[model samples]
Target: METNLNNQISEEWTVSEDAIGQRIDQYLSHKFPEQSRATIQQWIKQGYVKIDGNDTKSKFLLKGFEKIHVELVLQDRTEHLPQEMPLDICYEDEHLLILNKPVGLVVHPGSGNPDNTLLNGLLAYSSEQKKLVRAGIVHRLDKDTSGLMVVAKDGETQQRLIDLLKEHDIKREYVAIVRGQLSHTGHVDQPIGRHPTQRVRMAVHHKGKPAITHYQPLRVFKHFSLMKLNLETGRTHQIRVHMHHLGHPLVGDPLYGNPNRIAADVVSELKDLVRAFPRQALHARQLEFIHPITQQPISIKIGLPEDMEQLLEDIEYYDDLDTFDDQMDVEYVE
Candidate 1:
């Protein structure tokens, strides 16, 4: 057996004949004394552990001579610092707090992003929030996506909410501006997993986890559409990937959108708005779920953000011009 400790954090190890057949997480627990089995399992689940250059589950049985690589960010859990940041509180109670998370605020601390996250903000928002792991974050939105999220104030409520999410009882709805017009409702029932080549991105793969996204056209423009979407199965970047699969990527999505492919003949005003747009044109518009502790139904709705609202106006203006052109063409033919 060969053991290589890269630094105080991260390491590589070759599975030994004696350690063969043991669960990967269990093996790591005995190898790394500083971390617990649960922490090791979490690292595996989060794709921090790789066996023979591939991500595997915690229960994977090690084969002798297999190479294992692990990123050791779990050692830095204490580095998260509480900071006083503005939190848009939509609803709050002793059991939970529903917040409208602003764009650009990371939900939790991780490698390269060590401080000033929403988790830190929640820690400072209330002392009781500190008691819950990850500030009771039951779900997450991308750092650039602005919208609603619920934070549990206690352990019991946190677990309850987590279970509710697993059961798919929590309803989450989003609004987005896509690059092309969509005439009717559509659903993308595809699977999503890590991109095989681009490690940082996600892609649709047959072997990946199931992801279902249902979208309807709320308003259509000549070159853009306002859409409302609901998720039946949550996967990372599910909406963005599904929309891209449908060939109507979100207007401002830097990852999945092809900005260069935007129609060349678009009105200058609408084009300018698209160029000025900085982030993805996606927002969590509504959320409905049962209160974990109170055992009552709850719902919340919010309108588009300032940037999205402005972009919608530009789309409408361009659409009006197209309508006028169509009418003129019809009259000229007569």
Candidate 2:
């Protein structure tokens, strides 16, 4: 291993006879246990890894006595500094933590949001998270979409959780209020990708990654329905995009939902309330997985946040009123 003034690291390795026929990325993962295989693959794709003075693919088969070289530019960690903030911890152990993330909290730092994100808060909450990638965040929720999230406290646990997600071993359930009434349970098996023109939004496209969401109606209202949703595959803005694709975009989804979709007969007050909803009416309601360290099954369920609860209550009230009015009209005609 060698390091220069620019903080770039260069390392070399010689393949042994016993390790013949191993994939380069797999071999590198074994050598650097702390780094993820995905990261190593990215390094290989970027021409940072070479075999026998030739750039190689991550899947390159290794032969005995081949010289491998790797160079990586270290990322400066100072940019993501710790910021003290409140955390809604649902469950915590030495290996992992289950958090109930609230609405309006950014999960990570990005272009406009350079600090004061969940990552920064995690850094303040646990110094050990600094050593883990993305502060041990295996998956993510959109800033306005609040719900449960699992965070690992160590590298091995992080890798295990990531693997569980990849294998769909983790069970995640969500609750949402959508713009249209649904009478039956259904599932959306579609693909989702970044919008062609709208860079900030996601859309259902044929060329996108495979995505699936199963949904059941909990309560059907005049113009809205409360839904129970489970993710078969976690894609970016997946539920929102799929629901939108079905023409029942989630209530209060600023990007994909249309306020005009509300039923004209819906009481004026309810219409105003629905239109004024501040964020997507979606929440991660449950999470279930096997504990990496304890080898135990873990399941957690949480109720709706205050705003969603209030909105649901209002919808129920107005829907019942509409029903009563219709009953009265029929009786009068009789």
Per-candidate TM-scores read 0.73, 0.78
Off by over 4 Å in 1: 1-79, 321-334
lDDT of 2 at 63: 83
**Pairs clashing in candidate 2?**
none
Shift in Å, residue 164, candidate 2? 1.1
CA lDDT, every prediction? 0.81, 0.86
Candidate 1 clash pair list: none
Per residue, candidate 2 scores C-alpha lDDT tens digits across 86-131 of 9999999999999999999999999998998999999999877886
Residues 1-334, model 1: lDDT tens digits = 2333433356787888998789988888777643446767888888988899999998898778999987743333334578999999999988888999988989998887888999999888876565456877889999889999988886667777888888999999998889886757779999999999888878999989999999887776778878889998889999999999999999888889866568888877778779779888899988999898788899999888888888888777665434433322122100
In model 1, what lDDT does residue 189 have?
92
lDDT of 2 at 62: 88
Scored by TM-score, the top model is 2
Q: What TM-score does candidate 1 get on C-alpha atoms?
A: 0.73
With candidate 2 superimposed using the best TM-score fit, by how many Å does residue 132's alpha carbon deviate from the native? Answer: 1.0
- Candidate 2 matches the true fold with a TM-score of 0.78
